[model samples]
Target: MTDQDDLLPIGLEDALPARAAAITRAMRAVLDTMDAHGYDRVRPPLIEFERSLAGRMQGVATRRMVRFTDPESLRTLALRGDMTVQVGRIAATGLAEAPRPLRLCYAGEVALLRADQLDPARQRLQMGAELIGSDAVSAASEAVLLAIASLEAAGLSDISVDFTLPDLVDVLADEALPLAADQRDAVRRELDTKDAGGLAAAGGQAYLPLLYATGPFAEAAAKLKALDAGGELASRIEGLEAIADRIGGRARITLDPTERHGFEYQSWFGFTIYAAGARNAIGRGGTYTIRGSEEAATGFSLYAEPLLEASGNAREAARDTLFLPLGHDTAIADRLRAIGWRTIAAIGESDDPRALGCSHRLEGSEALPV
Candidate 1:
């Protein structure tokens, strides 16, 4: 094959084992924090029935999910676009009998559709937890803690969480503005573009006050409350304030009514995590109570590429080591297997009693002899 042919497919690349290991360590740290909080770990397959995946997501994310058909049965299959939906399915069907308020955590790659600008096709190595069947604000609160602790546990300290809710838009939509549904979406698009003039044109005078009112969280929260935003919107602002207070007000929390774009599925609280120098947000999670279910569920996904990029400087370097024993290769391999290593065969062929293959190479350690 030619060198050109060796290149990876669009929006996908093979991560070196070392890089993948770094991601795994980061994910493990986050998962450990979740596990400590009574969140059980579960592994779902990379692929599922297309109907299952398609019906669960929409927009660019749904389109980005890789799809295929089973060869034997011709059942449509798709690589998951997000882990939360898969967990929701598990809660609805797989674990329906287990219990309510199920706490589940997972770390894996989610395939998302590519955009021409900024975000291209990417396999998001994500670690996240879901609080299913829970209606308490505490469950939502714990999700934030787990997410923050995940970053802290992975050595990412200089991170910010911008917490907001979707209902703010609903509030705007309910106002007696003359703009139509499409116009509202356009105003939203204009706000996203930060075009003040465009926002004024679409929303007219009523929207200008809201635009000018934007500022640091304290000011914004006060304005949101003053708007008489009650129900979900009001409650979310209060929740965020309480969370900020609990976290000592040093967590860099923000209340953004403009955060609702592209996240139609997130019904209640929404948040995005940003590292100090990163141009884009690194992690995002939110809560929503879906229909046919009485309880609210919430969760977040930690993006692996950006997380590793921001976290490289904080991670510790450890020396490597290799261990292999003689002819009882399988026995030694099993013993080491219990120790948790992504074991690979050592170099050279040897049949000696003490020459069987097995090796442990710490991340950056010297290469093992064949």
Candidate 2:
């Protein structure tokens, strides 16, 4: 019964009825949560000029996006790998004059030409809110809290947030510790690997203490503060504490100050949120400056695909479903439907109410149990 020609691409699959319903439910909850916070939802086109798409973020990799020459424009067009960049484009161009600290949220599909080792899917649903015009401690705090709220709204529980100072090295290298431009990347790489010897060999002996600065927020922040011999990281450390205080018992907090893995564009204050059953981060966000507009912003994006696993009520709920027999009154059926009953009209006498997935049957203007 299976046709070889009908096979889908490696990382793409059809979301059958049940799964599609769950995806819709999850996406609606996330968008509603953002709307409740006054963040307007935006729908951006799935394709854009490669140049425009890559110019918004400083280190965006346009090569990873699915690209082709547009016949009409005769220029390369790219399928977006991230929607945050599109939100930035909207804020800078369309909403340039729209008040400061503009709040916008979005939910859409993003595609990559090739799949990542960590996340095998080439296409995924990305939902997030961007707070344009500020990347201050307060903005960072709001972004973190809102992200946690969005996950909770989607029915995810037991969430934990891991914090990172995206610009930790640059901040320290500017004063407390010094490193040549070439040495900075090496130190960051070693720190990411947690290789103590590699860090020391890269002229980052002063950065060795940063290696131990991982774990609970309180303990890790203390270690980072103590290692700030010249007070280079004092402001960042305090900012982290202020944001953590606002998070307060909402979710578990941890710190990994030198984490730059998924934060190529994040300036500082990046966070990755995890849920109980998810094997990887469910969402990530941080503060960063838009490249073209040069505007400051803080935001987070939650991948809905992963949230599906951690959510308990992903299945469609049982409701009042009514079956209308072939000879049933159309007026009565309409009234039942208007009152919130789901109705399935029978086209033939052989149609069974139970077979049609109905819980009730229309009988003389009354909905009787099927």
Candidate 3:
């Protein structure tokens, strides 16, 4: 028989000592950056009533929630699969009477019923900031810029931002195409795969130019304008351009107008942040309407696990800790700690401070390099 101690459920694994410490430090750094930018920190519960958590949100997939019944109340409660929705609920009910454009930031562990092919872990550490009650292009711009800044503060550089219009399909559908559901799906598939020939064959010739509009900001913007997609589509493209202009020289910006997989609920501009050597998006954000209310908001959630992996140097460079010998004055250790040193005191006699992973040992009153 298999050993029970060695078994763990699929998509569940422990983040051992070094990795866990690194993840926490990286998250704290990003949160501190957000806090410095006037975004107040908020901590929502890990579980809430399913109705309140899922509540008619476009992007939240209710079926993927890990739900259970509360024993006392007998009401269905769900482990928060996504904090974005919870933030929206807080804004609508708890902070309903608060001022417009409330800025909030949060960080916590989210449990999902299943994992995507790209991200096999169902449990993940999520850190993000939400700008509620504003849908202006400026708000979107702020969200994107702040996301980039936060990642940089967390020791990630060479970041790239990919912008997308999640409602591009709806925008095209409103045109006089009159294609059936299946036909539209086919066109979307073509666009998603960047199959120019297939898209043209399926009455998507109007969108064919967007396939080539995938590159650096200026080039993509020029190609997009050349398409002359007037009305709302043109307005959306212009918003993207405005954001790119504001984000000048910070990091690389790219446009993928036809892509539409991740932003299920985003109505206008959506984006994904990428870093060199990271296999998945470091962060994602977009604009969406809060369910049960007319409030429009924009925000981004950064996945800490992949980001920690990408910042390999930061992960390995934990603070240098000093090991104190037994019978050493406690006041001495306190002074060392006050000066930003991590002091590990010896409880029993042990000469090998290196075994405890300490970089230095207390010799006399000073900490000498071991």
Candidate 1 per-residue lDDT over residues 1-370, each given as its tens digit: 8999999878888867678678778888888998998999889898888777666544335565677779977997888877777777777777878786788998888875554367785677878888888745676677777788888888787777776665455555665344567777777666555577887787644555555434567888888777654343556677777766665643676666666654567766777888775667878877776443445788887877778778763444543334443333565566656776445543444533123333343223333443
Cα displacement (angstroms), candidate 2, residue 171, comes to 0.7
Give lDDT tens digits, candidate 3, residues 83-185: 8888888888889898989999999999999787777799998899999988789999999999999989888888999998777767767663445566787
Error of 2 at 37 (Å): 0.6
Task: Between candidates 1 and 2, name the one with more favorable TM-score.
Answer: 2
Taking the tens digit of each residue's C-alpha lDDT, what string does model 2 give over 184-237? Answer: 999988887878899999999988888889999999999888888888778888
Lowest summed lDDT over 10 consecutive residues: which window, candidate 1? Answer: 353-362
TM-score of each: 0.79, 0.97, 0.91
Alpha-carbon shift of residue 306 in model 2 (angstroms) = 1.1
The Cα RMSD of model 1 versus the native structure comes to: 5.6
Best candidate according to TM-score: 2
RMSD of each: 5.6, 1.5, 2.5
Global lDDT of each candidate = 0.68, 0.90, 0.85
Ranking by TM-score: 2, 3, 1
Off-target runs (Cα >4 Å) in candidate 1 are 57-61, 72-75, 113-116, 175-184, 212-215, 229-233, 291-295, 313-315, 318-370
